[model samples]
Target: MNKFVYWVPAFIWIAVIYYSSSTPYEKQDIKPWLGDWVNLSWAGPYLERISFTYNNQEVSVAAQGIAGFIEFFIRKGAHIGVFFVLAFLIYFALFYTVQQNKNKPLLAASAWAGTVLYAVFDEWHQGLTPNRTPYAGDVLLDAFGGGLAVFVILSVHRKNGRKKKFNIE
Candidate 1:
């Protein structure tokens, strides 16, 4: 019962994000959101700050980087990357939380499965939402997100191990 309770919130939160992301909003609402995210947050300033002049126009390096890297490649397909990231991160979170305890592998796998399923369902939910169109491209992003989480967590583990070896030697 205790372990089940711990698992409940992770699944619920991921489910909520999955469903909500699929819900369509007015373009007016979306525009502000995009603006707020890319133009108002720390990313906004960071992007704006790292600009360079080209043809008398100061272009944000961060914006260019994001566009050229994350968006450009991702636009080619949905479900190729980001959604996986969502899944992977969730798995990493689950594993990290349970690292010092028992049943780490089972808990991690369950979280990973939940994340991937959530992405799939999220795409389905998008199909039903108004003003939103389901794109396999987004699903790709989700997958990428998951893969990235795996990369990050694994990297951290490796780094810590290396650091411990260095200290001992």
Candidate 2:
């Protein structure tokens, strides 16, 4: 029962991810709210200078306008931040549920692998949702988020001198 408790947070987070992915992109757009809250005219020149092709579409303030330009980054940042927390929750669950004496490196790797797999699943789900386009780059971003969380956890353990517990080999 206690082991099941350890897994609850990860499961809940997975559900939350699924719910978010199921929402149509039109419903999730926050550009109107952003436009109402602040003046972005001053940012136009700087944002306009930044432009790139993503998934065969041009992404720029000139193309999307100031509010949309800001929203674009917010959405991308959410992908990284959400996956980072998910990775940590998964690592915590694994730490308590896995057999004793396994090194922390193995646990962290497992958590990261789980995170990347979920990221792939999430993009696939988004592909099925209305107005949502799954980009491979977003999956890479999610993996980077998971990797970052593992790096921080390993660093903390190393700094605390838990050499035997955190050993890679």
Candidate 3:
């Protein structure tokens, strides 16, 4: 029971990603809602204060345009952010589930493998959904997210000498 607890959070997060992905990409409207919210009268002056030059033209004419761009970045960033958390959870679960005397490197590698594999599976799942096509680039991004988390976790563990303290070989 104690060992199972470590996996619960990972499973829940994966389920969340799966549920969200089940929605058609065209139907994903978080961006429009966000654009409307940011277009409030009170936000006009604040939005006006920000400006950027794109193709030698000032591109701050409309708040909605900027909001749409922001939304695009937010969506991609969410992929990395959520996968980072998932990888960390997977690392903890793997670390605890393996027999005693496991090495930190091996545990980290296993976590990365699990995360990348999941990313592949997720993209495949998305492909089966309507109007969604799998992209190798997205898989690479997911792997980067997961790999970064594993690297950070491993560094912290090694810095703290956790291997010796926790009996991780």
Candidate 4:
């Protein structure tokens, strides 16, 4: 694969994150499609069962305003998920670009560092948008997601050993 090809998806995903953050709260909240998906009758009871403690009170999804609560999780999940993909792609791109004898651990660390920096930039970008206040907590969440991606990649790479090739076909 061309080295540049690996970067395309990562850049595009980052663009998506930026676009999502740029939307005003009201415009982004409870997107009709998501609202429909989460409200399916078959999943209603399970969704209601999901809850978390905030301010010393247990808040169920329904109690929190069903659509709003679900939207919060969806947005946070997107943060985690997009960063995960970004880190993974960065690692693979670096792996291919660097010399074969270069230390793999360093490449993994670099990928994570890049992901962290991107998360910070992402938060800053959000701060520039009206009705959006960047939170440090979201950066931490992004780091956790990137870290998980690096851990999974390193673990599998280690398990397979250096000599083995992963044949997708």
- Specify the highest-lDDT model's number: 2
Q: Which parts of model 2 are misplaced by more than 4 Å?
A: 162-169
- For model 4, residues 28-50, the per-residue Cα lDDT tens digits are 77656666765555555778878
Error of 1 at 5 (Å): 4.0
Once fitted onto the true fold, the runs of candidate 1 whose alpha carbons sit more than 4 angstroms away are 32-85, 92-113
Kindly provide the TM-score of model 2 when superposed on the true structure, using C-alpha atoms: 0.92
* Candidate 2 structure quality by residue, lDDT tens digits, 5-59: 9999999999999999999988898999989988889999887899998788888
Writing each residue's lDDT as its tens digit, candidate 1 over 1-169 gives 3545655655676666665666565532433434446643444444545655533444454645433322333333334454544555566457656656645445545655666677777777877888866666556566566655555656666688798989953
Model 4 lDDT at residue 93:
80
Candidate order (TM-score): 2, 4, 3, 1
Clashing pairs in 3: none
Candidate 4: worst-modelled 10 consecutive residues by lDDT: 160-169
Ranking by lDDT: 2, 4, 3, 1
Q: What is the TM-score of each predicted model, taking all chains together?
A: 0.54, 0.92, 0.76, 0.76
- The candidate, 1 or 4, that scores higher on lDDT is 4
Ranking 2 against 4 by TM-score, winner: 2
Please list the residue runs of candidate 3 whose C-alpha ends up more than 4 Å from where it truly belongs after superposition: 39-64, 162-169
Task: Rate residue 22 of model 1 by lDDT.
Answer: 61
**Residue 109, candidate 2: C-alpha displacement in angstroms:** 0.7
Local distance difference test, each candidate: 0.56, 0.92, 0.79, 0.80
